[model samples]
Target: MQSTNLKFIFDHSAAAPGHQHDARVFSESLLCQRLEDGWRPLPQGVLLGDSGYAMRDFLQTPIPNPQTPAENRYNAAHKRTRSRIECAIGQLKNSWRCLSKLRVKDPAYAAEIIKAVIVLHNRRMDQNPEDLPAPEEEQEDQCPPEEMGTTEARAAGKQKQNELINFFVR
Candidate 1:
C-alpha cells in the first residue's frame, strides 16, 4: 500500500508466484487477515481498492453501474485517487531497475530483495524530497464491475458507498 504522497505504507513482502491474481495475493496477506479480524489500520479513513477486492466498510471500490451523475462522479474520483498507487509503483520500478525484471529463483530471496528495494526507495525519497513527481493527468477509466459475491461486509460497504455518493452530490 502507498500513501497519497506516493510513499510506501504497507508491503506484503511474501512473494506470491507471478501467476496468482492480485486479489488472491491480497486475500492471503496478513493485512487482509487482520482486517477480517477487525483491525482498523487507520483511525478515521478508508482505503480505496479495485473491483478485484472484496468490498468492506473501510475498503471502498468503484460503483459497477453508476446511473446517477453523483455516482459517476464518485467513480471518477475513486479512479483518480487509486491511480496514485500505480504511479508510485512506476516510480519505484524506474528508480530501481532491478525491480523491473527480478530474476531471483527463490521466492524467499525475491521477497527479501523487494523489501530491500522498498526501504532504499523510501530512503531515496527522503534524501531527495524535491524529487516528487507531478501528479499524472486524470485519464478516463472504465470502472470494472465488483466481483465479490454478496456478503455482510459487502452490505455494509454498499451503505457507506451510498453515503459517499450523497456527499459528492451535495
Candidate 2:
C-alpha cells in the first residue's frame, strides 16, 4: 500500500499454511522481481516497510537497534511515515467487521471479499473520512521479524539509509 495516497498497489491471496513469511511472498511478487531485474524502474520515492520486509534500494526498513541519536531520530521518522499505512489498514478492518473473522469457505472467495472491502474502504475514505475511527496504537506483533536481502542489495539499502540518517541528523 502507498502511504501518501493510502492506495493499494497490489493485492494477492495465497494459502496461509505454506506462505507464512510476508517477505517471501513480497520478494517473489512480479513487481519486486521486475524492479530487481531492471525490467522496471523504481518509483520516485522510497517505500517504508516493517522489519519483516528485507531492505532494498526502493524499500526502507527501520533500524532494529539504533545506537546513535541520529539513527534513533531516523527510526522515529520512518515509523511515523510508515504508520499511515497501518492507519489505513486499521480503518479498513474497523469499517468492515466481516474482515475481522472471514468465514469464507473458499480461499479464492476470501480474496475477492478482501479486495471488495478495500475498494469499499477507499470509497468511504473519499466520501466520509471523518466518520472513521482513529487508528489504534501499533501492537508488538505488528513489528515482524527482520529478513535480510542479498548481500549487494543489503549494502545498497544500508547506504541509502545512512544517507537519510545523515540528512535528518544535519
Candidate 3:
C-alpha cells in the first residue's frame, strides 16, 4: 500500500484461502480497523486504491463509468498516482528473484520473508535511491470485486471524488 508521502507502507502476505481481496485485507488491517475512538481518520490524506477497494472518505477510486470530462481527468490522475505503488511492487519483485515464488511451504515463514524484503527494499532505496531501476511497463491486473462501504461513507467518498474532479478540470 502507498503512504501519504507516496512511499510503500507495507506488503502483507496470506495463504491462498486467506488471500482475500485488497479491500478486505485493508479494512481488517490494524491501522484501518476500529481505533480507540472509532475508525481511524485519514487526516494525512486520501489513499488511491484500485476499483477492488470500496470508495470511502479516506480512500478514493475512479468512477466505473465517467460521464464528464472532469470525471475523466480525475480518473487519469488517480491512475497515475496509484501507479507509483504498483511500480514499487514491481521493483520489489525484480530486485528479489526469490520473491517471484516462495518455495517455502509455511505461509507464516513466507510472510516473514516478505517483511524482510520490504525492509531491505526501503533500506536500499534510502542508501542509494538512484540505484533502483525504473519500473517496467506492465499489463494492468484485473479489477477485484468492489467492496461496498457504509452508505454514509460512500456518499462522503463520492463528494470527495467530485471535488477532486472539479479541481483537476480547473
Candidate 4:
C-alpha cells in the first residue's frame, strides 16, 4: 500500500431493522459478530475504536499481533486517527434526523436507509476529508475493562486491560 493511503475504522451497531437498539452490546462479540471477517493487518494500517470496540476479541482478534507494547502504541495512534470516524458518525446523525430517530416502520426500509447512509458517508469522504473533524474526550469512564467472559478469555482480557491501564497510569 502507498503511504498516501489512509485507513478508517468505524463502529457498527447490528440492530435488527425495526428493533430497538441497545448501545451497550451493539458491537459486542456475541452481538455484532464481525471477528470472523477477513481483516489482515498491514504495516501502514490504523484502527479507529470506540468504547464498544474496546474488547480484546474485537481489536486483537482481527488485527495481527494486537497484544503487545508496540501494538498498543499503534492502536493508540490509530484511535486518534480514527476519531474522525466518530465525528463523521456524529455529524451524520445530526444532519440526518432519520438516523437518530425511532427505527423505520418497515424493517427492510430501515436497513436500506442505514446502508444508504453509510454509502453516502463514504462518498462524501472521497470528495473531501476535511468535512469531518476528529473527536475529543474530556474524561475517562470507570469500567474494569476487557469485558468479563470465559475463563481463558477472562484471563487474557483482564491481563491485557491491566497492562493498558498501567501504561496510561504511568
lDDT, residue 162, model 2: 89
lDDT (10s digit) by residue, model 3, range 31-129: 555421255555647777777777876778877899988888888888888777778777777787788777787777877787888788888877886
C-alpha lDDT of residue 69 in model 2: 94
Model 2, span 1-170: residue lDDT tens = 45377655544444343335666666776666765665534455677778888787777889989999999999999988877877777777777889878876776777778788777877776888788877666553354644545789878888989888898788
- The full ranking of all candidates by TM-score, starting with the best, is 1, 2, 3, 4
Clashing pairs in 3: none
Residue 67 of candidate 1: its Cα lDDT? Answer: 99
Q: Name every residue pair that clashes in candidate 4.
A: none
The order by descending lDDT is: 1, 2, 3, 4
The Cα RMSD of model 2 versus the native structure comes to: 2.8
In terms of lDDT, the poorest run of 10 residues in model 2 is 10-19
- Clashing pairs in model 2? none
Predicted candidate 4 versus true structure: per-residue lDDT over 1-170, tens digit per residue: 11222322334443354443232444443323444243434432323334433444233321234666655674575556554444555655654567777455776677667767766766666888576544334332233333434566535544655554455544
lDDT of each: 0.76, 0.72, 0.71, 0.47
Model 4 lDDT at residue 166: 59
Selected candidate, larger TM-score, 1 vs 2 = 1
- Top candidate when judged by lDDT against the true structure: 1
What is candidate 1's lDDT per residue for 1-170, written digit by digit as tens? Answer: 78777778654645886666556677678887777677886755777877766777878888877999999999999988888777777778777889868987888898889888888888888899467555444443334444554488788878888888998898
Error of 3 at 11 (Å): 8.3
